[model samples]
Target: MLIFLDYFLLFFHIALTAFNALGWAFERTRKAHLILILLTLASWTVLSPYFGWGYCPFTDWHWQVKRALGEGPLPGSFIKYCLDGCTGWDSDPVTVTYYTAVIGVVVFLLSCGVNWRAWRKSHHTQSSEIA
Candidate 1:
């Protein structure tokens, strides 16, 4: 069961990360993308002082499962772990963290911009109809 959970979390995290990055592109997912990106940013910034920078509860739980599965000491960044596993490249943790942060912020801003534009469009349409 633990192994099953480990795999579940691995794929789930990957999918969530991908969604957080690109979900804003779809009209159906823009709102959810904004919320998820905000949560991700909060996890990285608001909770950083208490949990350290870029802290994610999902990552924390996944790490616990991995540790229970007898994995040796894992890297601090989940992205780093995934990159190393997928590409067989032992990338630097600092570089991974920096890129992860930059990409995350960029995605967040994109999500906000798209959502705002969408909201403004709908709001204008509604006002025009009412008039």
Candidate 2:
């Protein structure tokens, strides 16, 4: 049961990270992308100031599960963690965090821009039809 819980948390963290990075590419996930961007912004602005710049709630919870299961110290960056697992490369957490932040900002802006354009197009069409 505990092992299963740890794996579940691990999977959740990975999926959420991927979704955060690439969700904007799919129209069906645009809404989810907006919510994720807001959540991530809140985490960075509101929670990070209190917890730390690289702080992530999902990662924190996942680490807690790992510790409970007797796993050793966890990696600081989620991207670094995944990369280390796959390639056995030791990555700097700070560098990974910086890269992640850059990617996140780009994706957030893209998601917002795409959604805003869609909203405007729909509104314009509606106004034209009403005339």
Please tell me which predicted candidate would have the highest TM-score against the true structure.
1
The sequence of per-residue lDDT tens digits that candidate 1 reaches over residues 1-131 is 99999999999999999999899999999999999999999998999999999999989999999999999689888899999999999999999999999999999899989999988999999999999
The numbered model that scores best in lDDT is 1
Q: What is the TM-score of each candidate against the true structure?
A: 0.97, 0.94
Q: What is the lDDT of candidate 1?
A: 0.93
Model 1 residue runs over 4 Å out of place are none
C-alpha RMSD in Å of predicted model 2 compared with the true structure: 1.1
lDDT of 2 by residue, 29-112 (tens): 998888998798778768876898867887788788888889877887667889889999888888888888898889899999
**TM-score of candidate 1 relative to the true fold:** 0.97
Question: Candidate 2, residue 57: CA error in Å?
Answer: 0.9
- List per-prediction Cα lDDT, in the order shown: 0.93, 0.85
Clashing pairs in 1: none
